[model samples]
Target chain A: MALRDEVQVGSKDPSGFGVHRKRFVYFALIGLFVVQSGLTYTTSTEVPDSAATLSEQARHGEALYREFNCTACHQFYGLGGYMGPDLTNVISAEGKGPAYAKVFILYGTGRMPAMGVSEEQADALVAFLGAVSATGTYPVRNMDLTVWGTYREMHTDEK
Target chain B: MKSEWTAAKGFVVAGLIALLSGALFGVIGSWQHVIPGVVDAIPFVKSRPLHVSLVIAWIFLTAVGGVYHYLPKIVGAPLHSTRLAWLHLAIFIGTGIAVVVSYFMGRFGGREYWEFPPVLGIPIVASWLLLIYNFFRTANKHKGPWPAYLWMWGTGIVFFLITYTEANLYLFPHFTGNMVRELTVQWKAYGALTGSWNLLVYGTAMVVMERSTGNTAIARSKTAFLLFGLGFTNLLFGWAHHIYPVPSALWIRVLAYGVSMTEWIILARMIRQWRGTLEEGKRGQGSMTGRFLFASEAWVFINLGLALLISIPAINLFTHGTHITVAHAMGSTIGINTTILFASVFFISSAPITKNLRVGFWLFNGSLLVFWLCLVGAGMVKGYYTVLSDLPFQSIMLRARPFIVGFAVSGVGLFIGLWMLTWAGVRTLLRTPGDPAELDIHSAFLVEGPGSPAPENGHAVRQGSTTTLQP
Candidate 1:
C-alpha cells in the first residue's frame, strides 16, 4: 500500500531497474500521462465552430444511431467500418443535404441497408450530421503538410 | 479438497467457450457483410458487437486467469484471497450475460466496440477493481526484484481500470457535446485501453515461455525489461496514430507516428530470438502450447510490420479508414493475441498435445493467413480509390467484394479450427487434476506454482492437481 513498499520492496536487489531509478521512471510516466490527458481533454480540442454543440434533436439522433449500430457500417471521421462513406461532412457536402441524407436513412442505398428509420427519425439524424459537419471536415483533401508529417491546418484556428 | 486451482481452470473453460461462440458470431458477421439481409434474426449490427465483446472477454478471462494461477507460485506464497477472485469472476460473467441480453433486445447506448447498455459497465468496473486489489496484494509478495512480466501485469491491472473508466467519459455532457472532442477522446481511451490488455497478454506470454523452456532468466533479463519499457511508452503515446485523419492537434498525431516506430525495435528482437527458437521449436511438435507460442511469434512479426507501415502519415492518408485498419486489428487480435492465449490455455491444461490438436493448429493458422491477406487486398483497393479518386462507397465496395467473399469462406475454416481447439482446451481443463499427465508441469518446477517442489509453500504442496507437467 505504501508507495515505497510498492516501488522498492523487492528492489532490495541492485542493478537493472532498481530503487530510485525505477520509482523515478514510474512516477514520471504517470505524471506525463496525467498532463497529456489534461491537455487533450481541454486545450487540444480544436473545432471549426466553437458554438456547434449537439442539439436535443441531435442527441436523440445520436441515441438512435447507437441503437441501430450505424457505426457498424458507417464512419465518423473515417473511424468506423468501411461499408459506408465518412458521414462527418455528408450533410454539407455539395449535392448532399438534409433531404438526400434523409432519403438514405429512410430507405437504404443498394450497398447501404436501410435502418428502418421513420421520417421524424430521419430528420433528427440529418440534424446530427449537420452539427457534426459544422464541427470539422474529414477526408481533408488539402495538403498543407508540415515537414514533420503533420497537417498544417490542424494547429490553426482557421476555417 | 479446497483446490483453488479449480477456480483458475474454471476461467480457462469459460474463456474457451467465449472464444468458440465469439468466432462463430464472427463467421456469421463476415458472411452477412458479403450477402446482406442474411441472418435477419441476429443482423450484422447485433452480431458484430457480440463477436467483438466475446472475443475481448476471451482475452481478459484467460489472461487474468493466468495471473491467478501463476502468481502464487511466482511469489512463493498463497494467494491473497480466493474469495475475491471468485467474486471477480462472478461479477464479470453476470455483466457479460446482461450485455448479451441487451444487445439481443436492441437496447444499446454505449460507444462503438462497446455497444452494450452503459449501466452494465458498473459491474464490469467493480470486478476489475477486485482484480487490481487482488493482483497487487499477491504480486507484492514476489521475491527479489520483480521480473519484467510482473511489472507488465501490474501496469496492465491498474491501467485497465483507468482507461475502462476513461472510455465512459462520454456520459458527461462535455465529451458528448462536440464531435471532434468526442472522437478524439473516444479513440484516446480506446488506444490506451488496448495497450492495457496487451500488457496482461504479453506478460502471460513471457511466463509461458519461461515455464515451458525452464528459462527463469527470460523474464528477468535486461532485454525483457527494455521491451516492456518500450511497450509501455507506446501504449501511452502511440494511440494517436489511429486518428491522423481526424482534425485533432498536430502534436497528438505526430507523437503517435514517432512512438509507433518503436515496434521496429520489437520486431528485430523477436526475429533474433526466433532463430534461437528454431531448433527448440522443431522438437516442440507434440507440445500444443509450444506450437501456439511459435505461431504467435510468426504472427507478431507479420502484424508488427503491418502496424508500423500504417502508422506512417504518408501511407495512413490512404489506409486510415479502410479495411487496412480492420486487417491490422484482426492481425493483432487473431494472429498475435489469440495465438498467445491459445498457448496459455494449452499451457495451463498441461494437456498432452494430440494429433487432433496439431490438425486444429494448422487449420486455424492456414485459414487465418488467407483471412488476413484478403483483408489486406481489399483494403489496398478501397484505400486507393477512396482517397485518390471520388468513387462512391458502393462502387468501391463492389471492387472489394471478391476479397470479402474470400474472407467469409476462410472464416468458416477459422471457426472449425476454433471449435476443435475449444474441445481440446475444455476437455483437458475438466480432467482430474491429479491425473498422471497433470503432474509433469509442477514436477519440472523451474518456477514456483501448483505442484511447486518447495515444501515451504504449504498450499501448492497439498494441492497435487496443479502438478501437471509442461508437455
Candidate 2:
C-alpha cells in the first residue's frame, strides 16, 4: 500500500515556523494526554468495595453488560426484566463460567436474537456473571426499570 | 470522450434506482410524523430500516458511479472492463434491494447500520471484492506515476475493505469482550467509510477543477495528497469521542484530536491555496454556480470550528453522542460533499445541458443554507436544553418541531434541485445544445487555473449552467 505516497509531500523550506507549529501541536497533545490519563486513572481506581473484589476482566465484562442493556430483558437476581430466563444462577446451571456464557451469547436462544456481542464482551460478561453467581450479590440496581416506572407514574398522575 | 456504453448504462441505471428509492422513502419519512402513534407502530420499524438503508445505498451507488466516471480520466487509462463495472453495479444494487427487503421481513441482525444480516452482507462483500479486482487490475495495467487523487482513492478502498472485515468479525465470533474496543472498531469503520468517500469526492473535484481550468501544478497535486493523508489519519484515530466513557489509553484520545486537527488544517490550506490561484479569463464573469461552490468553502471552516469545539474535553463530555454530533455529520455530509458534487455536476453538464441554469443554482444554494441553519440551530437548542439544562430529550425534540419542519421543507427544495440535476445529466447525455457561452469565465479559470478562484466580494463564483436549486 503506497499510503505514504498518497500524502502531498513537499520539500521543507528550512523555516522555524513549521517546526514551531509541529512543536506546539505535539505539546498540546501531550498536555491533553496527561490530563485525560489522570482522569481515567482516578475513575478506574475508585471502584466500590464489591467491584474491587472482581477481576479486571470481570469488571470489564460488567461494564459491557451494563452498556448493552442486556438486563432489559433477562432477569439477574430479582433485578432486570422478566422477558427472558433468570440468569442469577446461570453459572451453576451451565457448568462452566466463561466458556458456556460465551456460547450462549454468541449463539443466542430461540427467542433472543444474536446481539453481535464481541468475544471480549462475551468473556467479560461471563466473568461478571460468574462473579455475581459465586458471590450471590447484585452489585448495581437496574436504573432503567426505575426510570421507566417513574415516567409511568408521572404520566399516570398527569392523566 | 471514450463512450463506454456499459459503464454509462450502469451509472444511469444506478442513478434511476437511487432516485426511485429516495423518492419513495422521502414520501414515507414525510408522512411518518403525520400519523402520530402510527410512526412508532411495528410496521414503521420496517419502514425506518428501509429509509436508512436506501439512503446509504443511493449515496454509495452515486459515489461509485462518480468514481467510475472520474478515475479513468485522472489515471489516463481506459476502464479495465465495462462488463466488470456492470457486474459490480448489478451485485451492489441487487444486494442492496434484497437487504432492504429482508430488513422489513425481520431477517436482520438488528445492529444499527450493520443491520443487514450475514446473508445480505456476503453478497455485498462479494461485490466489493469484484470492484477491488477491477480497480487494482486497471491500476496495475497503467504504467505511470498515479495521480494523488487515484492514490487516495486506492488507499481508501483498501482500508474500506479491511474495516468492513473487522466490523463483521465473522472470523472471531468470540471477539466481544471489550465494549469500548468494539464500539471503537464500529466508529472507526464508519469514519473510514465516510473519510474515504470524502477523499474520493475531493479527489474528483481536484481532477475536474484541473481539467476545466487547464492547470496541473505539482503544488496543487501536493495539496491534494496532503489533504488525503490528513483525512486518512483523522478517520483512523478520530473516533475516540465515541468511547469517551470507556477505559481507553490516554494516547488514543490525544492521537484522535491531533489527527483530526491536522485534517482540518490540511483541508483549509488546500481551499486557501486553490482560491489564491484563480484567474479571471479562465472563469468568465457572473457564475452563480461558482459562487455557491465558493460558499461551500465556508462550510469547511464551519466543520473545522465544530471539530475544534467537540475536540475540547469539557464540551465533548456533554456533546458526545448528542444531536450536536448529528448536526456535525449533516453539516459535513450535506454541506461539504453535496455542495462539491453539485459544483462538479454543474461543470460537467454545462455545455451539453440546459442553458442559463442560474435560477436553479441560486435556489439550490439558498435552500441548502436554510436547511443547514435549521438543523444546526435546532441541534444546538436541543443539546443545550437536554445536556446542560437537564430537560427531557423528548421535550426538547417537541420544542424543536418547527426546525424539523423547516428541515423537511428544505428537503422539498433539495428534491427539486435533485430533479433538475437529473434532468441536466440526461440532457448532457443526449448531447443537447446548451449555451456554451453560459459558462462563466471566472469558474472556467478557477477550474483551469492553478488554484480555486479567490473569494470575490466574500462569495465564490459557481461554474456550469445547470445549477440545481437544491440543498
| Maximum-TM-score candidate | 1
**In model 2, how large is the Cα lDDT of residue B224?**
43
* Pairs with steric clashes in candidate 1: B438-B468, B439-B467, B439-B468, B440-B469, B441-B468, B441-B469, B441-B470
Candidate 1 docks with a DockQ of: 0.34
Across residues B1-471, which tens digit of lDDT does each residue of candidate 1 receive?
134576677777888888988998999899888888788888877888999999999999999888887777667666789888889888988898898899889788888989997889999989988988888898877767887789899999898889989999988988777767778889999999999999999999888766665445556555666788888988888899899877776678767888899889877766666655564455445477767877887888898989988887877877888888998999899998999999888877877767888789999999999999999999998888876677877789899999999999999999999888889989978874721243365333333443233221100111111222233
lDDT scores of the candidates, listed in order = 0.78, 0.52
Candidate 2 residue B96 Cα shift, in angstroms, is 1.9
Native-to-model Cα distance after best TM-score fit, residue A27 in candidate 1, in Å = 1.4
Local lDDT at A124 for model 1: 84
**Chain B structural similarity (TM-score) per candidate:** 0.92, 0.80
Error of 2 at B419 (Å): 2.8
- Name the docking class for model 1: acceptable
lDDT of 2 at B313: 49
TM-score of chain A of each: 0.81, 0.50
Candidate 1 wrongly placed segments (more than 4 Å): A1-15, A49-52, A109-116, A143-159, B272-274, B434-471
Off by over 4 Å in 2: A1-159, B1-5, B16-20, B23-44, B141-143, B218-220, B246-249, B267-295, B346-357, B430-471
